[model samples]
Target: MIIVTGATGALNGFTVEHLLQRIAPSDIGVSVRNPDRAQHLADQGVRVRQGSYDDPDALRHSFADAEQVLLVSSSDVTADVITQHRTAIDAAVEAGAQRILYTSALGTSFNSPYPPLAIHAATEQHLAESGVSWTALRNGFYGDLGDLLGPWQATGTIAKPADGPFSWIDRRDAGEAAAAILTNASSLDGPVNLTLPSPVTLTDFATHAAELSGHPVERIAVEDEEWIAGEVANGVPEAAARFTLTMFQATRSGHFAHPDPTLSRLLGRPPRTISDQLREQMVRTE
Candidate 1:
């Protein structure tokens, strides 16, 4: 059986959906915090068990009879993420899983300006020393570029702190690729860069938004401190604002610029482009 954690989330929910298409639902089990939320999956012949990273006994029971366990990384910024990951990794090993797969981010490094990258790097290191087979799906950035761009359509300007090239990928594509990897019996161990084939900068994003919406858009770079202060004054938490600032710092340092063909190869087709996402965003707002 293959066990997947955080099955209710967008990324892993898509993973579970794709897995059902490729394998027997009986061969799949989901370890989620709320079994009630996964009742739909359970009705489809999947084993739904209540589990949390903080609960070792629960995680062990949830991970039982597992050939492989796909561990979704924690998203709680205020919590000790590394500790939570370690607990999950240890539980998977204790449950006698043959292999452990982790959802990590691309450009993960201890020296990164982004704190999340450092956390992922530490988790990868723990996985290497866990005395079990492991694979880290190093996924590219997947989020609304519109959040960073602000209301470019209405304001005619994409304003943010300085940023560099980023290879943003669709979350669904990354989730599908992960499902493919789980169902295959290939020896693809270690970190795999799952990213789009091209990179896009904020300026490029502005141009795409302009062309897609048929509206003029200008890319304006704000100083780091100024952007943070402005966001804080507008009710954004100080910590959250600073956290976003580090992403720009990392991007300018060339952390998120690299693009690889591994994701396209896995999916057997080219992944969706930034323009495609921007077009969808415009349609939704309209």
Candidate 2:
């Protein structure tokens, strides 16, 4: 069986949905913090295991019978995420999983300043040291702006301190890459940098959004304080408001690295273009 952690998340959900197309529903297993919440999977005859990265014992139980397990990284804060991933890696080894596929970011390098790369690099290191057969999908920015990849794109304008070129990728590539690693889980060796090679600037994206959506997108450069004010006005809570601002600020530098389209080669086709995905999502909203 192939086990998928974070099965219900946007990106993870797409990955599992695609996998279901290739594998019998019975052979798929989903891991979530709340199993009852994933009744959709349960009803589909897929096994649902209750677990979290924070709970090693539960993780061991989650991986007990699975030959290949995709360890989706935790979305916790940058400071705490590495430890959480390390704990999960330890359990996967103890459970003797035949292969482990991790969703990681392009690690700390000259390409970008996304701080999470340092953390993801550490997580990838842990997976490598775990001694299990492994593959790391170093995913880049997603296509949609509402998501982690290009929230800037969602508004059709990136409002941040970022002034360089950046790439946007579709989640379909990420899902396909996961399926590839899991399908050939046994033979897979190392990592795939899931990003596009050529990147576009935020201004480049703004012009496209204005042309496509016909929405007047004004790119406003705001200070940290001004940004937080806008987010709070937009419904961000007080306690977490700062952290939320920090996330975008990090991306102003970026956590999701530059586009590296390596995953597309394994997918046997090009990934979705940001504009195509954006148009569909907007139609639903309209």
Candidate 3:
């Protein structure tokens, strides 16, 4: 049996839905923090079990009878993130899961300034020492480039501090590729970066947006402090604004710049691009 954790979340939920198309429902189980919110999955014939990274016993129970398990990294941004991931990995090992899959990030490093990178790095180390065969999907940054580029629907100006290239990707495509990996989990090993084949900078994206909208969208680069002040003036929370500002610094240092074809090879097609996503957004909001 194959078990998927965080199955109710947007990314993993889509992964489970796609997995259903490739595998039998009875062969799949969903381990979520709250089973009450997962009745819909159960109604679809998925075995729903309650589990949380905070509770190792629950994880053991949730992973019962599973040959392979997918460990979706925790969303917690605090120091507890690594501890939580370690707990889950230990539980998966204790539960006799022969193989494990993880949803890691593209620029994951032990020395990255991004807090999440540390969490991923630590989890990978623990997974390696656990003696369980594992695969890490180094997925790209999944954000609305249109929003970052211009908040384009409302503002025709792309405003931010100078940034570097990002191979922006669609989450749905990531989910589909992840399902494919799970289907053949045994053949793959170590880290596989699931990113676009092309990387685009914010300036290039703004140019494309202007051409698509037939409007003159301007790309404005401001000082980091000024950008934070502007975001705060627009009613963004101080902590959120600061965190977002640091992301640009990370970007400028070439964190999210690499592009890989692993995702396309898994899906048997090209992953959706920022332009494709923006065009769909425009059509939907029109």
Candidate that would win on TM-score: 1
For model 2, the superposed segments whose C-alpha errors exceed 4 Å read 107-113, 143-158, 185-187, 215-259
Please, what are the lDDT tens digits per residue for candidate 3 over residues 1-286?
Answer: 8899999888888899899999999999989999998999899888999999999999999999998899998986654888888888889889999888899998888877676777788888888888989888888888655447657657888888888877788889988988898897345888889998987777877787888899987888889899888888999988888888767777888998888889899889988877788788789778
1 against 2, candidate with superior lDDT = 1
> What is the clash count for each candidate, in the order shown?
0, 11, 0
lDDT per residue, candidate 2, 1-286, as tens digits?
A: 8889999887778788888888899899988999987899999888999989888999999888888888887877633888888888888788878788888765343343445567777877887888888888777666446643235535545675434444566777788777876776345577677766566555655666677777766665567777668767988776565654544555556454356656667687777666666676667666
Better of 2 and 3 by lDDT: 3
Per-model TM-score versus the true fold: 0.97, 0.81, 0.94
Candidate 3 stretches greater than 4 Å from native? 144-147
Displacement of residue 97 (Cα, Å) in model 2 is: 0.8
Task: Return the lDDT, model 1, position 61.
Answer: 100
Write down the lDDT of every candidate, Cα atoms only: 0.92, 0.72, 0.85
RMSD of each: 1.0, 3.8, 1.7
Ranking by lDDT: 1, 3, 2
Record all residue pairs in model 3 with backbone atoms less than 3 Å apart, i.e. clashing: none
By lDDT, the better pick of 1 and 3 is 1
- Winner by TM-score between candidate 2 and candidate 1: 1
Give the better candidate number (1 or 3) by TM-score: 1
lDDT of 1 at 66: 96
Q: Where in model 1 is the C-alpha error above 4 Å?
A: none
